[model samples]
Target: MMRRLLWFSLLVGLLLVVMPAAAQTTSTTAQVPEAVEITVGDEVEGALTEAAPSAEYALQGAGGMLINISLISEDFDSYLSVRDDAGTIVAFNDDSNGERNSRIVGLAVPEGAVYTIVAESYGQYIGSAAQTGDYTLSVSEAQVLRIEYTQTVEGELTSDAFSLDYIFTGSSGDTVVINEGSDDFDSYLRLLDASGAELFSNDDSGGSLDSQIGPFVLPSTGSYTIRAGSLSGEATGNFTLSLNRIESQAIAYGDSVEVEFTNNAREHYFTFTGAYGDIVTITADSSRTVDTDLTLNDPYNSQVMFDEDGGSGFDPEIDSASLFADGTFTVILRAVDSANGTVVVTLDRVPPQSLDEGSQIAGFSSSRTQIPMLFTGVAGEKVRLTLTSPSGNTSSSLNLDVRQDGTSIAYANANTLSAITVEFTVPNDGDVNLLISEYSYTNFQFEVTLERVG
Candidate 1:
């Protein structure tokens, strides 16, 4: 009798292979789910048991619907599978979601085809081990969220209280902003790293019910998550989410680039790659009421230079001829005093012009009375520079003021002679600026010569 019972059990298991999957929900007693219609955004509660190892449901339509089947079971490791009406297995899942539960997301189904969703104990799929539990099945439209630079997304918060998601790909030390200023509802924002761990969250940070979280630096170059939500589950209204990437514009030598600030308290960054001891000047111009405030950051994001009122009438300027480092340099442009406007920025690398042991360069300050020039000399080298005019004697005396990085180094005034000469030992390997100003009313041509002797 014992041998006969074991043979019958094995025969019954073999017979299950030939039966419809919906009818094979139980090991011994066959059970099938009644055909039920379901749609996206629908969450249903159901249970499974040892007596009925699987539950089958019908999705009335054909394929092309992105279906997400989630099975939550506390009593057993859950498993999920989908099959066509003809009992052909289409998809399966064991632990794609989390823990021992199962979830199948973003599965595209066929058109005009009926699919059977089956939930079962993971053990039952392998052998005769019986498992039972209650589970919740969530069916919703799975959307692929992607965020790009300067993108604006508009959405609504309805009674369902859905959380909108977006994926942001960024680099380390990059600052980004998530703004919901146009949201009518009490908005909330949350930032998550690639692993879905919360990095930051903000509510009512924009001075109103809307949300704004930013100047947030990314930890690495990868995908990050931004969740747009409401202050509470009950609050619902329309909202707009905007993503802005704050990265420096790489300004090469003699390159001119333009950037704008759409609003106040926003920072625009421009980067330039230069060598150590290089001199650079940045000029910001705007036609609007926008007064620019400029800040220079080294490769390590450290503040090395700042200017708020050094330009032509409220514009920002940076005219440093001696840079300390030789890497990426960041130039930050901000609107002054909470003003918003467009600003055109240009960067010029102004290194010291190299002169030979005895070289001469001629220039004229004819149309203007003042001229500025730059030159370089080596340390310990006795350098002699002579500034002369066309006439042997002029009514106006020419004044010469030479400076190294804004510090006065030499000065000369021609009272009655045709030329002014200044000879001094080179202080360092830096550039010197010559400010030639006329003290009298005379338009004159000038020649500057430098001779090195030591």
Candidate 2:
């Protein structure tokens, strides 16, 4: 009986040893730890050297759990993927280019359920035996306000006499007061006039925070536009604008005018001296157009002269007339309607010189040659010179010299290849003569006219 009991005891001990070995094999095949107890600030680390088909873990908390995941080692390519109990992957970062230190952050893991974190390596086997580097996963809550907003102004606010138009809209207000939260982005606003001019603008300077607000005023309240964009040219946000009623005024021409234009079109006014052979200087404000043909006529005689266009329609001053005849003369200046508006004209008189009938001169050449031709004339008198070339050949150069007896008063050169116009004034209203010459071997056609100015 004693021998049988001894044998039975030995068999029971052997069963205990074999049962523990079977349990160890089962645990190894499962691959997951029985109970992973992780605290709020603790980090879990593991290594992976190859692609993982599946992985998992579980949290114990009830609410507001956050996770920051990262690759902890730089030796092998590390990629992280997270999945819920049903095997749906919720977060992942892969080292697509085989980078050794690939990482991503703030992946949320659900509480009370198994959250699987799978690490993968591009070219190496990943598991407990073949893994080469460690990956870290952490948990926490995320902060509010992912990105702040801002504003900025672009383009000029003023040009010429009119103020530029500006516009401001979106969440960005006109008077933004910047604060700690106003650092991430920018906003834009502008106010434009009827002429498409920008008058005012606002950006980040008026905001309390980076995000936009309201209470922006328009330069003048007819119809204004607004736009908003990022200061760094990236990121997404919004802006807005508020408008109030305001009074405005505009200027217009009055009724006390010699030549009145009833149609809202631009016009020019010209006046001629009726008694004295006086010089008249006509000045128009830059707001008015200048440069055109000024024509003067008496009962039997009339004359026309060219005036130059003015720059910067702000302060336009043109010497429009120089009268040498004593008869009653009527004047009119003509211009193309380049703009829409009323133009104002002002006229004043200066001293004039005595008139004289200039002597007519003519020149002819059989072949293309330079010859010294001379003629005489009076100062402040209209002088006309004409040259006719044979029809076929037009390439030639003509030079003219005007002199008082032997003293040269003026010289001019012209081309027969193209029609030329030359006008000059005589220094003295006395006997003036002219000399003509050529420089090229071709027939020429030319005409010259001169009107004196006082």
Candidate 3:
């Protein structure tokens, strides 16, 4: 006889073509009887024996109604099948929702179509060794729970329904965050049509045993489904499911936006329009409690830069970077390696000032550490760049970085030098940044002079 042990693979929802011409329910004699009439919320008790091994019931419901059928049996490994009025099986199962018993879900037969529910032991239904037992078959309407925005719902991961399902509606560009947390089980979360772009996930990608999916942007306007269950199939317990909507705001050239992260969400996103050939800087700062990570993606969804701990301690900053494309760019803010908290992100556009031959621009290193400038030079032409601190000439530290097409052609830092002066042959002509930083925390002002006397 075919015996379904729980540890064995619990295959469900497979068509059975070899069902015996059998009978059912407290009888040894085989009978060709009509299908019993039933409806939702009906439970019928029957027996499956070698001679009388199967029984059928006809269901009447409104058209387009979704329903679930279950065959539970302690005395036998149950099998189930549902057929429409046209005699085409709509659904069948050997194990339903990770159990030895059977269940058919989302069975939406045509309106006015009759659905026949068949129940039998696995072995007898497939024409194998004879088996007999009592069973309880149930039919109910399909239920899809909804996790509302900012609402936390308590749920249980039970064997009968290993995966709890919820749905929400979203528009084309809406970003969403979902969290599934549990102290008893390692939670697992999945989106039904999950081929869309995702900004971040938590638990598995967030932190610790909590499970989260999204920071996912909906690609269209419709109902989206979220399935929550245990990461490990063996776990079962109480869990919480939450949904949060992320509102993206436009960022200007030089403004700071502060956002927070909870255990439910670990990442946030912002967008900005940048012009081609623009030089910009971005910084993310938070208290010591938060470790920030930042990612910049161009309009084509390609990553322009990523930074972690490139700012002050536990913060992230992208310094003096060039933007080659003119379009809307995305900035991703994330918390890494620690509990989530508030983070302030700022974008600064550094307009290039002319540094022509024998010209000098007085600049200061205050909150902004780098000053961008444009200097045109021939491929083989050499030039000398000089820096002087007004607090005292050559008294403060400085650096000069020249770049072409985002690649560095020449770089110079004061290190142990008393003066910051660099001379190099121009490599393919572009722009550079003359930077003065608080070396040893000594605040100072400085000027950079470009000379063609190389």
Candidate 4:
């Protein structure tokens, strides 16, 4: 009878094990939905148990609209699977350490797609120790942001001028306005396109003291950058920029010279002069193809001067042209395009007559009435005189007195050296006096050259 009772007790225990409450419910019905909550700076959780096969969930639409997914579970030894409604496994997380309790899984979902998260025991476990845990799921819409910018110049924008306000806009229909404040600095504002291409930029206007404010239009509906900074010849300042939409043409002068395009082609002329040793910088800009040429021309319409070829295309640069005589000259830039566009050109002249190889002098005396010197100059022309000594040293004084046929043509002192350049036309043949005198005993050196500026 006791043995019978023992056998009955064992049978009852087996029945209880087979009908465990947690294991029975696992296969009885579909998995129930769970809730997940999150706060800023907190790691997202709740995916581990929700992704189990026993807790089946379905996602809707294309996957791209689904931005992100996350899960958390204390069952570190368990495995989790994430799938779409079509049973496509999108993500999985597994841990073999049974002692560890925390686990997480995440995936970026495709837009307009359905997804499911499933958790299950790794191996064949008929009823793995009555699996039980609380799980939560959460979904939120993704955010997209974009910006567009445009700039325009309304009136003359010059070196010392005021510009009008600028405007700006955002993807969510937000707006801003920028104004030029008094800061005494030259500033530049530009617009960029979606592909990181510069569409427009503006500075001071040609021959003007102030720059005008204008509107800039973005080429497409996407992201963009608007930049502002100080340009050359001005101090830094606080300026305002705005975002708005308006219809206007972006007309920018290329450099110093103002160029206009009527039929997509035009030409302009300019002139410059300097000492024999100075260098000049020339710059040109055009929306269409352009060509520049610098030539030395005679007064009789004959091309007697140098004609350095100014190459084709926009913004051609050339440097260092020497003057051989004292006369009028011309530099020309030609811009052309099948499409209508404008060109702007500028020339920065540095007088080359300041010094060359011939202006050095050697002497040993504190007081000298007349000092003889030799200089190579243009035939029949007088040479300008310049003298230099140690700054703040009056003892090392010197004077360069220039003469032609015993008549004083030019004189220069060490203190006033830079402003003493003289222009004298050569008579086609003769010797000119290049004299030097010492006011006190001090070593001195200088450079001299002849310049022809016709």
User: Which candidate has the top score in lDDT?
Assistant: 3
lDDT of 1 by residue, 1-454 (tens): 9999999999999888767776757555746466456666667777776566778778755365545667788888998898888998877888755568777644556567778888788888786685887888777765647878689888775544345667778888888867775446677788877654578887765444766565566889988778777765345678888998765566777777766567533677676787655667788887646877777666544455567776788887875434656677777777756766677888887644344434444343332344556677576678788876665655356788777655677898877677878998767786766666664544466677776767
Kindly report which residue pairs in candidate 1 clash with one another: 62-112, 63-109, 63-110, 63-111, 64-109
Candidate 1 structure lDDT: 0.69
Residue 299 alpha-carbon offset, candidate 2, angstroms: 75
Of models 2 and 3, which has the larger lDDT? Answer: 3
Worst 10 residues of 4 by lDDT: 96-105
> Which RMSD does model 2 reach against the true structure?
28.3
Ranking by TM-score: 3, 1, 2, 4
For residues 217-310, what per-residue lDDT tens digits would candidate 3 score against the true structure? 7777776667777765436899888888887768989899988889876777888999766878899878677887887767655556667777
The clash tally of candidate 3 reads 4
lDDT values, one for every candidate: 0.69, 0.41, 0.70, 0.42
List runs of model 4 lying over 4 Å from the truth.
1-255, 271-281, 287-318, 336-339, 353-454
lDDT (10s digit) by residue, model 4, range 1-454: 9999999999999889888765756444335455222321233334324334344445443243312233334543455566665877766644311232213211345445556655444441244443445443333322222233444322222322222212234443222222232245666555544332355555542112222223222344555444443454224444544344432222221337566655523444454443322234555555444444443222222222222243244455454343323444345444433444455656565432323455453333422233444344466544345443324334335566665555566666665342235666544344455555554544433434455464
Cand. 3 TM to true fold: 0.46
Considering every candidate listed, which one attains the maximal TM-score? Answer: 3
